[model samples]
Target: MRFSWLLLLPLLAACNSNPSAERGEPGFGAADPESPADATALPAPDTASTKAVSAVSDTLRTVRQKHNFSNPKGPADLFKLVYRGPSILDGTGEFTITNPTGEVIFREMLTEPDLEAALVYEMKNPTATRAERETYVLRRIDRFFVPSQFHTPAIDPNAAFPTGLETLERATWDDLQHRPDAIGFDYLKGKEDRQRIAWSPLTKQVVRVQ
Candidate 1:
């Protein structure tokens, strides 16, 4: 875990930090699951999803999916995702990571806008339909936490790091140069919003690199 801090530091510079849309913070700015703009063009569900629903009344869209990062130091399936809404096109996503024993160490929220903003590449045509957009977002969630998504020593040691790190982040960044095995969770909120999270054994918790 000590190495994890080192790994995530470099990611701070690489990812976007929206003052109003941070993951751990409340709202995630996802006011309405189905935006009026999107719903106007989208049709009603032909059938409800078979996935088990939580206590909430809103549609439990993307069923909680457990992802095993399988670190080199050996923790299997550390991350889990629980989402609610009709679908990601208009959903709220809960991102959490736990230790081997299933104790949650980190948690955050992402709304449709937060996740959808990054899909501009897929929806290049401003007029793409709701169905087409949903297909793309769903695929993003499916492949979110695979091994290929995690980075070993998330920051390339040889690459120049960002210059604005705070005291603790700077220390972690400096230490990461030697920890080739340090693993960092990596994903994107949108095209410019790449997120990389790492664990810190010293802090006994996970810290957002930025």
Candidate 2:
């Protein structure tokens, strides 16, 4: 899938606005007893401050290659690597996979388990392209994936949020807007859309859209 350069506008805006967005979290691994259980229970050491995290990521890939996980076959198999922007302290992120026609298959915030699974899948499948690998890697380091257990379900009488990772799955595009620094991705070909989206903490409405 080819993408126009215009797709990058939102990402560029995010990058320029926060130069340190990619740095992960400061003192991410430092012990903090006062931190919430959600904060301390992270799957892996924060990637921003250490090369070891990258090394571990690579090893996981190698193992997955040895096992031969399959490449995504359709929209259902497709996964979107989402990053919440710089405004949030933890740089929350998500993994969303949609079907070929653009229906969401699954959405999970990046957690240690989710990242490990994604990395292994990318490594095992020879058909998985560079773009896919890069997207996975970027999400791995960006600190976007938060454990789903942290969020309380917004009040709605009709639907019940799925438990575990499924809890991270969002029910609508409107939900995506609520996320800080929300960015969308096409994992297979490495294309990204929804470049113009910003959330207003004050008004709680999508403040910007492109």
Candidate 3:
């Protein structure tokens, strides 16, 4: 009787495992073992670099907007904008001004051979006829902020020159040479006051301001 009971135990367990026949309902967890299906799998993708770039971009925008200036470039990109001077000792380049992203936002290369001529032409062709040429000329002259003494002999401030007129560029030399009120050329010998108090277009008066 014990051996017969042991043989019947296997049959009882198998019937219990079948929910549809043993219980009143079908088993939810049961699946056909022989069912055919496609296996779902994919190659693991590398996202490290993509994530890094996104993080850097976010940080860059936040930093640039803090200053009034827009989209300033990173140090590497800034260095790439080689001045290739005659640029003022101040690092003002003759060619291009770029943002942090390597985009050229401003360019001074209006013409070849003569940068001053290009500046004069731009001044002469004022956006508004009512605007004075002197204002534009002064503004453009300020762009040539190189700290080293004038490279060309024609513009040497040291050479005997008139007062009030400062440096003797060929242009200024021609205008002030015959004038009696001319102060002294040596006045221009000092560091150029790029921010010198001059007439203000916005105020329309000689304001003692930048």
Candidate 4:
């Protein structure tokens, strides 16, 4: 599933739809619930501040390898590593990366929230031959994997895991753009063709592509 960069001018330049564009379907940027027990719980944190976002990312990175994708400990336990205290809802999430030697490499804060219970992520090894930055996202829907009642297999509706590499790459870029806290990240997943592009905040050029 090779993606051609020459194509995809439409999606790259498409206009972002309003929150109501989906006819009341909650937009990714909508406000998150105030409590984790809220019915319409969102994955965001309590405060979308820079410090809070960084804390969230750092936590995720610390637990990325320690966590058992096959079995989770608990939401409170998971959040504790990242929040340094109680976790709060704020409509923003973080992405973190770790090297094979268990050293922190890179981290980014996004609009994804409260995924400790249902999401799993792993950064592609930076030393790979192609040197492409890729991350894996998943959602856990199946319970019983963890001792706590909150156990479930993290599922990624937008993720294309079993599919080829192209879908997987597109999902990653899409996730970044969908973030409500993305003030510096630039993402581009071309439309009508298998193309993906991501840019940094400063240079405004393609940093990753597929």
- Top lDDT model: 1
- Residue pairs clashing in model 3 are 72-100, 73-100, 88-146, 89-146, 89-147, 162-184, 162-185, 163-183, 163-184
Q: Quick one: best TM-score, which candidate? A: 1
Task: Estimate, for each residue in 1-210, the C-alpha lDDT of model 3 and write its tens digit.
Answer: 999999999899886685664443536655433445312333467886773433333321110111111211224212111233222221222333344565754334322123223333454354534234334333344433332411112222344544544322444454333433322211021133322222222232221111
Rank list by TM-score: 1, 2, 4, 3
Model 1 accuracy (lDDT, Cα): 0.65
lDDT of all predictions, in order shown? 0.65, 0.38, 0.32, 0.32
Q: Candidate 4: where are CA atoms >4 Å away?
A: 1-63, 66-88, 112-207
Positional deviation of 112 in candidate 4, in angstroms?
Answer: 4.2
Q: What is candidate 2's lDDT per residue for 1-210, written digit by digit as tens?
A: 237667887788876654333443445444454578747676775769664434333322111001000112221224345444332222334555444455544444543333434465447665556566556655554433233211222222343443433313344434644443343321221222212222223343322222
Candidate 4 global CA lDDT score: 0.32
Query: Weakest 10 consecutive residues, lDDT, candidate 3?
Result: 60-69
Segments of candidate 3 deviating more than 4 angstroms: 19-99, 102-210
Error in Å for residue 132 of model 2: 23
lDDT of 1 at 181: 70
TM-score of 4: 0.20
